[model samples]
Structures are given as C-alpha cells and as structure tokens.
Target chain A: MANMYNDKVMDHFMNPHNVGELEHADGIGTYGSPVCGDMMQISIQVKDDKITDAKFKTFGCGSAIASSSIATDMIIGMTIDEALELTNKQIIDELGGLPAVKVHCSVLADHAIKSAIYDYAQKTGKHYKGLEGFDPNAEEEDHHDIPEEEE
Target chain B: MRQVYLDYSATTPVKKEVLDAMLPYFSELYGNPSSLYSIAAESKDAIAAARKQVADLIGAGEKEITFTSCGTEADNWAVMGAADALKNKGNHIITTKIEHHALLHTCEFLEKHGYDVTYLDVDKEGRVAPAALEAAITDKTILISIMFINNEVGTIEPVKELAQIAKKHNILFHTDAVQALGNIAIDVKELGIDMMSMSAHKIYGPKGIGALYIRKGVRISNYLHGGAQENKKRAGTENLAGIVGFGKAAELAGNNLQAHIKHTSALRDRLIEKVQAEIDHVYINGSMKHRHPGNANLTFEFIEGEAMLLYLDMNGIAVSTGSACSSASLTPSHVLSAMDIPVERIHGTLRFTVGDMTTEEDIDYVVSTLKNVVNKLREISSVSSKKGW
Candidate 1:
C-alpha cells in the first residue's frame, strides 16, 4: 500500500516545502471539508501582482497533504494569471502521479489555489480572465466532481 | 527501525508448533481423505482428530464441526444456509448493526432474496441490547445472528442473553466467533448457540481454513455442492495442511488460554494506560470491561486515522484504522458509525490488538511512537488548531 504513492509524493508529505499559515496574508482559501475526510487551507502573500510567499495547512490523507505541499511550492513566484493557470494535472504530474482515488486531492489543491486568487481579487478589487465562471463557494461540490473510483 | 506487531485481531502469525504439525501433511500424508486406502485412512483420521481438536476448544461434539474455506465462508454458510432452510417457516432475520461484513453482507444478500432483516442497533459502547433483539423478533423471524466480538471496536456482545431470547422464541441463533475462538472460552451448549462461525488465522493457525459449528438437530441447507466432504454439507477437497495447523493451534490455545489472555491483556492495558496518560483528547471507543483482552480502539480527537497508520508503519509498527480514507469504499467504519460515534471521530479511530507475540517492551515502543506521531500530526492539523487543543 505504500507503493500507492510515488517517492515524490512521499517526499513532499514527509518534508513539505511550504507549511503553516501566512500571517496577514493577501488572501486565504480553504477547500474540501472535514466530512469528506480532506480539508486544505492555502494562504498566499502577493506583492505587485506576483505571489511572494505561499503556505498551507491541510487536514487530509498523504496525497492531499502532498498535493497542498507541492501546490504551494509551485505557485510561490508566479503572477496571479500564471498561478490561476496552474491546474490539478500539473500538480499530479509534479508529484509523479497519485492513485485514481487520490486524484481528487490534486483537484482540491487546484481549487485551493484559484480560491485564494479569487479571495485576493475580491480584496484588491482586481479581476482576471481565470476568475471567470469560478465560484469559490462551489468548492464543496467542485471537489466531489472527481468521481471516487474504488481501488 | 523497531517493528512491533499490534494488529493481532486482523491476523496472527502462525505458531512454530502449528507449522511443524502441518509440514508432514503437505508431503508424506498427502492423500484424498475420501479414497479407501491406508494412506487415505491416515488423511481421514487426521481430519477427524482435527475436528475433535476444534470441537474440544469450543466444548462441542466432533460431529458438529464442518470445515469451510475461511471465516467468511463459515458465516456465509451459516446465515444463507439457515435462511434458505427456514424460508418455509419465516423470512425475517435479526442481527446487530455492528456485525462483521461477512455476516452483514450475507444478511444483505438474504434481504435481496426476499428476507426481511432487522438490524438491531448497538449502544455507544458497541453492545447490542438483548431487549432490542427480543423486540426485533416477529413470528416470521427464523434466525438471529450476532457477532461474538465486534471486529473493529472489540466489544463483546451479550451472546448468551441474546441466544436465550432466540431460544425462547424457537428461532435459530448463530454467532460469528472468529475473534472469540481462542481469546475467550466458549460453550455452544451453555450459550445456547445453534450455529457459530470461526476462522483459524485469528487464533495463530494457518489462513484459508475455517469451521462452522451446527448444534445437533438444527437443519440447514448446504453451502457448497460437489464431493461428499464435510458430512456432505460443504463440498470441496480438504485443505489438509491448513486443517492440521488449525488443529495444532487449537490444541495449543486451549492449553495456554489463561496465560495467553493474561499476557495480551497486560500488554494492552499498559499501552492504553500510557497513551491515555500522555495524550490529550483521546477517547477509547468501546467498553473497557466487556472487550476482547487484546483489543483497544482509540480515537485521536483532531487527526485522521490513515495518516497516523502510515506514520506508524514507517516506524515499523503495524496497526489498523477505521478511517474512511483507508477503506476501499471511502466510508468510515460502519461499526463505529452504528455505535453513535460522531462522523468526524470515526475518521480518527485506530485499533490496536495485542497477542502472544506482543511484549511489554513492544507496548512501550508503540506508546512512545504514537505520542510523537499524534503530536506531529496535530501540529499541522487544521481541526486541532480549530479545537484549540
């Protein structure tokens, strides 16, 4: 069962690059729920339209925690538009790959990124193309969009 | 890295004595028990001795035991066979909500086949009330099946009282005693249990071997059909080596029952006491007084179970969890849920079962490792911070 996740996922889980909260951050986004067994909170510090720092605290399994860890590491130096374009697929690819049931963990990471950007947009009265049709409130349903396949 | 095995309820390592007893059957004594030859007679005699050994452990007659593939098969045979045999008399079956999936799924299958099943609820400690079993019974109720000891939480049900209620109603009573076989003393006659399911592996015997005990005069349909094995009820070639191993294991267990229980219970108590003393917001899941000696189910307040299990695994310690993330179905344990544990708490539950292999040093290592793991997990857990723990 340890082989369910690749070395990268285990590495990220064991030694997460960015963890804890970014105090007085520009934006904060929390995705997933306790009821569903995976919850993540991603905080970002944005400066001049680029993310200066990003950190996360996750309440989830290995994959979810690894996804959040890697997602934070990926979006730290990117501009808001570049961060918005960061997909769950990129996170999965970066982490080698997750089990099919755990693909939703990457999806949660993607949503957490966008939701944080949305919160930043709302705070700064700024809007971007990626923000179109993005509803942070729909996170509960969005994480469930990935069909949970039995392993 | 230190390796400590504390998941004995999941399965135990086969004892050296059992393995030595089984070695000959795989080579020299390998013969079809049904064949009318000297070699076959040896095989047949070994099976008979094994049957008696198993029966002796349970205070049952040799004729009452029927070997099956595993405990699941024994449970399947008991519930499905009885439902089919008693269908003419009734279609209703009574069972507890905390049964192992072998019995619960069998009851579900029976439900699909036009049987009405009443899933009696368990108390917060995972105990099924005899009154609830009595209330669920109807004129059409033909059978009542309950687990002797719950697999997840280690709660031992009031089987004797529940069986008495079934006997009063003239309904057949069955108990899945897979976890109870070597851990506790059992007398089918004393308990009024008409049928009981058992597995070998849980008692330090080989896997892939199980048995069902049918009290005399209780008629049930056959589960398998082929050769005339197992008194023509379960049909299949015998697992000779496995049966021999089971016989040896049962004999050893019977001889050392008190010592095994004392050793395992001491280790379990030490582990629990240390964890409770060192950890905060940890709750034991089942009744302390009425549980299997080796079993301890603990719920860590703010962290999920799989994460802790993985950490423990990395430390070379083995354990089990009732968390949804660890389960194939992506749902928390039904047994914990049925016991009225909060859904979030169910995700945090872990089961540690000690056995003959466990030691005081192993228990200390587990407690220390668990403290570090729980503290580390809680450090990053949002739930823990939210609860301000």
Candidate 2:
C-alpha cells in the first residue's frame, strides 16, 4: 500500500512552510514525541480573541506535517473560539481522509491548537476555558470547547 | 524510481524454487501427513524429506527438530518448557539485555513466576562478553539463552564461547538464531548449541513456520500438548507446504551461503561508507568488527527516526529504525539503551539491512535519500531552536 501523504506534506516537512518559533508570542504549544517520531511546536498571535498570526514546526510523518500545516492555515484567520472547536475528524476530512493508523496525526494537530490556547491562557493569566479537563482520547464530538459553568 | 528493501532481517520474500516445490503440496497432493492412506502416505514422505533438509541445514538428526508456528513460539517453548522442567534443578536464567522480545518477554514472564533472571549488559558495540556469561552462571542457573546475531543492530554475539562455558558448567544453552539462520553459517554441533530457534520466513521460505533445533539426548518438556506429532514435543497438524518450503529454502541457503554473505556484506559496507562520507554527527550502533554481514545501524544526530523513515518512504526507499517488530514502540530501543547510547542519538537510529536481492544501486539510492532527509530535518531543527518560541 502506497503511504498517503503526498508532496505538499513532504514539502512542508522537508522544508517546512513556516519553520521556527515565535518570539514574544501570545501562546505556544508543542505536542507529540521524538521517541514516537512526531512532534509539533505551534505558536500563535491572538488579538481580541482572534488568531492574528500562526506558525508551526513539526517533526513527524508526512500526514502529520501536512496536518499541522493545514491546521495552522485553518486557524490563522479564525477566532480563538473557532480554532478551539476544530476537530481531528475535520482535519482528516480536509486532507481527503488519512489512513486509519495515521488518524493519530490528525489528533496531534487538534492538540497543538488547544496547547497553544492553553499557553496563551497561562501567559496572560486568563483561564484556558477551552481546555477544561480535556481528555485527548475522547471522541471529538463529545468534548466541549468550553465548559458550560466556568467560574 | 528504483526502490530498495533493506529490511530483510524483518522477513524475506519466498525464494522462487521454494515456492515452486510448495505449490503442489498445497493443492494436488494436499493430505494429512498423519493419515494412513495413499495420498496421505505421500504427504508423510514429503514431510520426512523436509525434516531431513532442515536438519541438514543445522547438522542435526531429523528426530531432534521440532517445527513450530513461528520463531517466537519456538523461543517460548525453549524457555518456558525448560524452566518448567528444571524447576528442581534451578530457578535462575541468564540472558543479555539485547535479546529480541521473544526471549526478553518470556524471561520477564519467568521473573514474575519467581525465577531469578540476570539480564547481562552489553558494551557500546552491542556485544555481551563471554566473561560476563561466565561470571553470571551459578549452580542454580538452569538455562542461558542468547541470540546468535541481533535482529536490530546485527552484532554477532559470542555464542560459541558462551556455549563452551555452558558446557563446562553443564548448563543447557539456547540461542535464538532466527535472524542468523540463513544469512550466516550455522551448525548445531559446530557451535555446541543445545537448543536453537530458526524461522522460515527469515530464510526466504514461507511465513508461519519455523523450527527449533534440540541437540540429541537433550530432554526438554513440551509446550503444546496434542496429537503425537513432532515426536510428541510440539502438537497441532504440520503445515506441510510451509515445512517443505522451509526445507527447500534452507537447502538453497546452504548452497548459496558464501556468495550471499559476500554480496550482502559488500552492499552493507558501501552503504556505511556512503553515509560516513556524506553525513556528519553520525555513529554506527554496533561493533564494526563483530557485526552481521548484512546489517548496518547508524544513528544520525538531531532528527527523529520516524520523521526520517517518513521522508525515505516518500522517496520509495524502505529501511527501519529498529527491527520490524518494535518499529511502533515509542521507547528508544532497549538494545540501544543497553549499549548506553544517548537519548538524542537514539531517536535518530536507522537500521539498513541488506539481503540476497539487494544491489549496489539500491545502496546508493538509500544513501542519497538519507543524506537529503537528514539535511532537511537538521535545517528545520536549527532554525526552530534559534527562534525560541
């Protein structure tokens, strides 16, 4: 079976479209593992609850690299609330459906967004309402973006 | 693009002649080897002939060979059965930390059952010294199981020296020769091996069939209990077609042994030379002097192994970070860890194994692809570190 991730993902991974960290960023989130062969470090610049700028560096499978790339593209123009609502399923759908085993790559992308938001909340002393007891293994549709009864 | 397969240590494609010999058994002459009819009698003869072929490969009597479902099962039977039988003799097992999971996990299982296991450490070259084996042995040491050659780093262990030591102490020694079977020369008598495991898939026979070599007059208990097959050592109906294929493959391997070794060793050396010439901050994993002829494990610093694998796959060049069995495991290799490789480089390790079919062109292609991939990953890592998010 030919592995699915094509040149777009390979191009980004080989010469990552936005390779490097953000200086004086609003938030930064890194996920995956060097041991497991997939890692993503994402930085976000948020203004007025909307993502003004986003960039990423991922070390992983082609689909993982592409998923992170496509994810940053999807979230850059959206509100923090919109990006928080992004699902791994949606990412797979967007990329023409990843192989069943490679579905974890999509999940890594979803977690990167949440991680960045959590970082933002940590830096600014605002509650990360999007990450209230987030269970990474839970089905995408079951988890809430923000808990209904936040203090 | 011409692709290369450098994972022969994982498994090999069935040889053409082995396949040809096996085709008729699966169809026209399909009959139970145990049945007492004309067709069944012919099946019995084929099974007997296969037994002789496999025995000849390792220089054992046909009665001493017990076929199993796979190498893992053979290993389990050797460890578990022997431990159970010799409970009164000793409760201690000695093995190296670099053993494949087949022996490692079984030793762990035995440990849980109150058996004392001393996991001997290896030097940076992935070789467990014979002196370590000599020191580890005690009156309570019932068995000592080490691999003939590592499936990961491909370093040939000091099995002969260890076997001689085991003999002096009268300890039953077993070697997992699954990866070493056809690629290298092996004679049970020559090495004084008491019990050894062999897998057919690794020798270009067929999958789902392997043999365990038990030296004559060595009494070990049975793992599977059923029909009086395999001299009542192992049970279940014989996989006749697989067994026959294994025999033919073994015969072919014996005939082409020297040529295959010379070709694979040269191709592997070419790959190593190319990598060393083109790359920097890389180190070979196992001992250069005592390694397998076909195995080359190199660790490229900075980049992760999985990312490198993805990049290589993109270019249609296949290799591995470790053995095929443990490829998905998130932990840095236990084998590499035992060798005390640093965490940074462990993530970057890649195993490139040559096979009978591998050529100089295949090695060059892999070298070029690897050079390109490493440079790219390193470039990204450097830029990302500087920005400091």
Per-candidate total of colliding backbone pairs: 0, 0
Error of 1 at B303 (Å): 1.2
* Weakest ten-residue segment in model 2 chain B by summed lDDT: B322-331
Q: Which candidate leads the pack in TM-score?
A: 1
Q: After best superposition, candidate 1 residue B93: deviation in angstroms? A: 0.8
Residue B160 of model 2: what lDDT?
A: 91
TM-score list, all predictions: 0.97, 0.84
- For all the predictions, what are the DockQ values? 0.53, 0.18
Which docking category, incorrect, acceptable, medium or high, applies to candidate 1?
A: medium
- Whole-structure CA lDDT of model 2: 0.81
For residues B13-43, could you state the per-residue lDDT of candidate 1 as single tens digits?
A: 9999999999999989999999999999999
Which residue runs does candidate 1 get wrong by more than 4 Å?
A: A105-107, A142-151, B385-389
RMSD of each: 1.6, 6.2
Task: Give lDDT: candidate 1, residue A9.
Answer: 89
Q: Per-residue alpha-carbon lDDT of model 2 for B80-180, expressed as tens digits?
A: 98899999999999999999898999999999999999999999888989999999999999999999999889999988999999999999999999999
